[model samples]
Target: MACTLLRRLACLALLALAGCTHSDFRPDYPRVASTVLPVPADAPLAAYATRVTAGHGSDSGLRLISDSNDALLARIALANRAVHSLDLQYYMFHSDATGGLLAQRLLAAADRGVRVRLLLDDLHVAGKDKLLRVLDGHRNIEIRLFNPFLERNASMWGMGKQFAGDFSRLNRRMHNKAMIADGAMAVVGGRNIGDEYFDASEGVNFRDLDVLTVGPVVAQIGQMFDRYWNSEQSYPIGAFHHDTPGPEKLEELRKDMDAHARQFSQGSYAHSLVARVGDLAHEVPGTEWAWGPTTYLADDPDKSNPQADSAGLNMAPQIRAWMDGAQHRLTLISPYFVPGPKGVAYLQGMRERGVAVDVLTNSLASTDAGNVYVAYASYRVALLKSGVQLFELKPDAGRGRHGSHFFGSSSGGNSLHAKAIVVDEEHAFVGSMNLDPRSVHLNTEDGVIVDSHALAQALLAIFADATKPNHAYQVLLDDKDRVYWQGKEPGQPMVRYDTAPQTSWWRRFKVNAGGLLPIESLL
Candidate 1:
């Protein structure tokens, strides 16, 4: 009891100190306005997109990218094929191998005279200023940070202090992710620019999803990008950094990035990715593309403003409408599944109406965010009682794949990072928005909703494979209402775990402890 009091006192002291600290940074810079570059008539990507989406009227061509290597390769391929412009917006862009490789590709594209606009959320850019400045130094490349911190070089504690001082502003984030090439084709999904997201991580890799699209949808996505790009929240890197890096510095960084890319290419994973390059043509062939009516859904950039009336700017209502309109079945795949009271009530209502709802989310062992799992766990019994079928991805789910899953076969751990919903196996929604309060209210998110039976079935097929006993645990309740996990491995016997399977006591303790806190809404 004394220890608890001491810790509380310490926290209070820290908060007091944070309250005393004032931000020295301001957003009073000359904001230069720019929009998405128009695609030239003879642009290669424009020609390809036009040829593929011809005679379809306003319908868009869509292809799902379930494999991690292919997702990275597709972005690189898009960059390579881009003739006019490349617009990239992401929540996080790491400086790891996959990020460096993509950065190298973007640099090469910029050298080819393609205008590159890279907009990233500022939450994760603390130690990446030099690299971002160097990228911004490029003649044809520009970078912006959204909802950035006032303190540029803040340490962990400093960041905490800043957040404590300005909780309302710092709490909000931009969670959108997209890559539009030549204003013709775009890759929009849950992935950011990172090795783990691309299945290149040696540790935990994300099992995510993305869709490559062309036609009218790309134009809509470009408009969405423009909305955020020119918003008051997005500030150019030059706004913070007055002194630009010299050409010599840029050349040095270029050589370093190129060397890193060369080294990364020498690896066996790179070879495998390169070997499958030809497979992309088969996947994205004009005839094979799924033609559909697609809607681009995004939250307004003003959602981040503390005083802004942003309720009408949310995408949650549209998503809820999609789910509410489900007549027969609904399948949801979210890594961080924290469905609060309203969500639970809504799902229960759907089940009451005889809708078959299946949800695939991260298990305690496989989840990166334990607090989210705890919050989600609170509703599991309620969800199960309401006839909502639940499945949790196993930590080793990626082991079965030879070299295809988002995380490589050799990865020590794997986690589900895909956020998707299929309604009645006829409509599909894929994007960065998760079914959590943070995504619904706190963060700015975007995605594509395609009214295509084929696309819905394709996404469902991926979900079906992932929910197999070997890859995931089918959650169930006993006669006594106690929850248990049912799972089976390939050629192995079925087993049941009364507690969270494959998890440590320490991990479980942390989750339980986290639940005692009043932070479920924040999860």
Candidate 2:
């Protein structure tokens, strides 16, 4: 009976694909070309950045934003401080509390004559056309969608049909995340614009990392943004929709968003955040900024094309070079880690060279992507054999605490979302690129490498806090070569689990069954 139902569903899917014409996919749309606006010499942001880096030639200033609320505040502060322009690129931007608050600020900036260019990947913007159209209706704001779907249907069946028709093109995604303010400073890291990323979600929240940078590297980031902004893949949001929302509709959206912001500000969670905005407005001048040589790296936009020479456009090699240069110690923090054979060999080689290697990733119970955990599990024994120290974040890692000095506190389940590498405690890399197949071969990624002992130490401090026994489990191999986990919670005795702890049997079965499939390359 199940097989017959499957057959009927397959037939329906085939018919649906057959019914779709070329117009059902991405259609030819007119897009106007634009470049980054030049930085006005007297702009306040530029002047501030200049004063801070007066003596540091060819070096950038860096500060790590490990707290979720601070991360959101950083972006909001940047948007509010912009006097000339703002360029933002991200994989996902939802319309939740944090997203709406930032959106309201972006609109406020636009109202002040800030040229706002928002570039978002189309995968997550299916039902938000009304909001986007209204924002695009503003003369000072121009929105673009990267690699959009013209059909604008987000249902399960619709996505399946689209995938059946154009699997290769639709599978490729732009995974880069960046926000540049007035061509003077930028923030780059693993965060997306959403409530969970900012600790405002009632459910699961992500512990992420971002670096606010200024000086020479900002120009490099601007150049990279321009390359993507002018690429053939970017389409003006107006091109996808035929009609623009009228002024009345824009005003309606404005009032609704304003009301939401006002209501949110009065809430307990946002009250403290609102109070901190003034300090953030001045870019936190009292905070010590690390000055160092920084190198910005990004995969070319053409990497979104499956037929493109991905190897030549890849940024993984540059990251590998940084890893290859590690001498004393190396640490990796990734949410979804599916290191293939080459990565295993590289880490083993580092171990052989007497470099202590440590890795922190999500455990099965803490991970949002079970398929990825399945693939990552396949190489655990090999990685252990290579003498790589492994730690898996606990599901409730950040619960029951106020904001710590390093990682911020959360009320619900916590998942690792920060992607970074620290080498010899003197250099660090932070950005959206995960150490997995999807980040390497499928999606375009970007990051910055800062050669600063202070920055590296700060990142190492975060790793230290996140990998404590209370916050994470140390993966180990018994004398019989069996995998086990060991950890202890605050005021509790040590515990051991032969299987993934804090997870149900059904979840374990699903992940183990998924491991049997030959889908590692697509992970």
Which tens-of-lDDT digit does each residue in 1-523 have in candidate 2?
9999999998788777946723433356667788889887889998898788887888898888888888998899899889999999999998989999999999999989999999998888754567988999999999888877766777876566677777777788899999999999899999999989988888889989989999999999999999999997888888766666899998898899899989998997787676654234364552478879999999999988877776679999999988889999999999999999989999999999999999999999899999999899888999999899999999888633542433455577888899999999999999999999999998889999999999998898888888888989999999988999999989999999999989999999999998898988887
Model 2 clashing residue pairs (backbone): none
TM-score versus the correct structure, for each prediction: 0.95, 0.95
Alpha-carbon local distance difference test for all models: 0.88, 0.87
TM-score of 2: 0.95
User: Could you give candidate 1's per-residue lDDT for residues 124-185 as a string of tens digits?
Assistant: 99545888888888999999999988777557776887887778998999999999989889
Native-vs-model 1 lDDT?
0.88
Clashing pairs in 1: none
